[model samples]
Target: MPGQENMTDVTVIRGNVYERLSHVIDPEIGRSVTDLGMIVAIDVAPSHSTEGVRAPGRFDVTVHVELTVPGCPLTQTIQDRIDEAVASYPGLELVPHIEVGAMDADKLTGLVSSLKAERRENPFNKPGIKTRIFAIASGKGGVGKSSVSANLAATFSALGYDTAAIDADIYGFSLPGLFGVHSQPTNLNGMLMPVTAWGVKLISIGMFAGADRAILWRGPRLQRSLEQFLSDVWWGQPDVLLLDLAPGTGDMAISVAQALPNAELVVVTTPQPSASDVAVRSGLVALQVPLKVRGVVENMSYFDHAGERLRIFGEGGGTRVSDRLTDALGYDVPLLASLPLEPDIREVGESGRPAVLDSDGSLADTPLASSFTALARRLIG
Candidate 1:
C-alpha cells in the first residue's frame, strides 16, 4: 500500500512540477524553460526517511536543464527560478535538485537558427510591433543626453515596464559605464543578448573592448553600427526602448528614423542659452525625418541648496527649446521636466549606478526619481 501511494504521489508531483516550470522564464531568452527546450527531463521521487520508509507528502524533484551555453552569467538566476518554482508547490514539501549542462552543438545550432528565423531582420520595423522608441538627443556635447537616457531607462524598468536602451552614441558610448555594466553581451552563435543592468536590457559599443571594439569601428559608415545593433541583438519586443544618440543633429537621428519609423525624439538641453539654442536644432531634425519631436528636458535646471533654489546655469533653456521646436514643427512639444543640478547624479552615476536608483536597483525615493517617473509617464502617454 505504501509503495502504491508513493508511486501515485510521484506521478502527480512530476506533472505539477512540469506545469510550474512552464511559468519560469529564461531571463536572457525571455521564454519559459519548458518552451526553450531547456528542461530535458523532470524526475520526481518520494523522499526516504533514515529508516528507509517513504516520507508522506515529501518528494525530491531533479530537473535536468540544458542551458543554451556553458558558464552563462545568468545560470545562477535560472537555477534560482527553478528552485523557487519547485519549492513553492502547494500542500507538499518539494526539494529541488537542478542538474545543469550546456546544449550539444547540434541542439545549440538548431535553437539559434530557429530564434534567428523567428526574428528576421530588424524586429522593431515590423508593423504592429508594440515597442515605444524614444531617441534622446542634444544639439551638442556636455548636455547630459546619455545621463538622461540611462536614468530614464532605469526609471521605466523600475516602474514595471519591459525596458531596453541603446548607446546609439557609438564613439561616445556612456550607458555601459552609467549603468555599471562591465561584461560583454553573451553571444549565442551569431545573435547577441543585451546585458541586463539596473533592470534595463542594454547594448552598446562600450560593452565591447580591444579588438572587438576595433572590429565594430572598422566600417566607414556610422549607420552600419546602428543597423547591426538593431538586427544582430535579440531584443524580445521590449515595451519601451531608449537610444542615447551622439551629441549633435546628424546621421544617427536619420538612421533611427529610417530603421525605426515610429521613434519619437526627446531633446535634452541645459539652462544655458548656448546649449538650448542648439538643442532646438536637434529636435528640428524631426522636420527632415518622419520622427516625432516628443518634448524637451532641461537638465541642470537649478540647484537646491538648503531651502532655496539657485538657478546655477541661468534659466528658460527648456522653454526656449520647447517653444522653438513647437513653432518649427507645428506641434505641441512641451518642456517635459526641468531636472535639478545635483552632485549625486554625477557621483552615483560615475560609481556605475544611475542616481535615480538605489544600490538595490529600485527607484530611489527622491525628487529626482519623482521627476523621472513623471517624465516617463508623459513620454508613454
Candidate 2:
C-alpha cells in the first residue's frame, strides 16, 4: 500500500514536479525542457507489490519525454538531467519511469519554425547587438592566421567571455582540428548547432561530412558558405566571434564584410617582410569594404632561447603592417601583439587543443597565453 500512498501523494504534488523540471535545461540547445516541449506528459501511479497489492511509500512516476531528435548523442545527458530534476523533490520517495521518444514531424517542424522566427536575421548584424566580430586574415598562407584565431578565441573563452569561432577557410578549414572537435554539429530540424570545444562555440565546414557538407556547401562557394555559417548555425550571440579566414586578399574578406557589416579585420602576419607585405594587402580589404581594421598580430616574431629573444623571421613586420593599415584606413590600427614562435603551438594544436589554453580550457599562465590575453583585452577594450 506504500506505492498507492506515494502515488496518491505524487498526484497532488505533480504540479510542483513540473515546476522543478522547468528549471532543467537541455544543455545542447540551452533551453529548459518545458520551453523546448520535451516534457510531454507525466503519469503518477502506484507500484505493485509481490502480493498483487500497491506497495506502501513507493510510486512509479512515468515521465513522457519527446526529444527533438531520435538517437541524439546527448540523449542520456538529457535523461540524466531529468532524473536529477525528479529526484530533487523534497520528502518524496518516487521511482522515475522515463519514456523517451522523438518528437513528431509536425511538432518538431513547428518548434524549429518558432525558433527560426524568433531569431529572424543573423543576431550579430542586428543593431545594438554586443557580439564583436573579428575576421582573422592573412595575405599569404603559412602566416599563422588560424593559429592566432584559435588561440585568441581560447583566450577569450578562458577570460570568461563567451566566444565563438568559424573556420571561414572553407578549403583549408582548421578550427575543428585545432580545437580537437571530431563531433559533428547537431541538426535540430534544418538548423545546425555549433560544436562547442575549448570553452568556445565553433562551427566549420570540416565538421560536416558527405551529404551534410554538400548541403551546407550549397549556393555560391565563397559568400553563400559564409552566409550559411552566419545565418544557418545557432551561435547564441557570443561576445566574440573569430573567423579564421582563408589566406588571401580576396572573396572571403568581401563576403565577411557584406555578411557582417560590424565585423572588424585583424590581420595576421609573420615578422618577415614578405609575409607582412601580403598581410598589409589583406588588411587593405577593409578599404574595399566598409569593415574596420582592428589591428595587426605579428606571429612568429621571435623565438625565445635562454632569456634571449631571437627574431628568426626578421623584425618589424607587425609594425609595418600596422603603420600601413593605419594610414590606408585612416584609423588607429595598432600592432596589438608580437607572438613568439613556439613549437608547442604546433604540437599542441596538432593534438587538438589551442596552445594558449591548458587541458582544462583555462588560459595557461605562460607568456603565450599572457600575450593572447592582452590581445583579447585590447581588442575588446
lDDT scores of the candidates, listed in order = 0.91, 0.86
Report the lDDT tens digits of candidate 1 across residue range 170-196: 877888889998999999998999999
lDDT of 1 at 103: 95
- The candidate that wins on lDDT is 1
Report the alpha-carbon TM-score of model 1 versus the true structure. Answer: 0.96
TM-score of each: 0.96, 0.87
Question: Which sections of candidate 2 miss by over 4 Å?
Answer: 1-13, 43-62, 88-97, 210-219
**What TM-score does candidate 2 get on C-alpha atoms?**
0.87
* Cand. 2 Cα-lDDT: 0.86
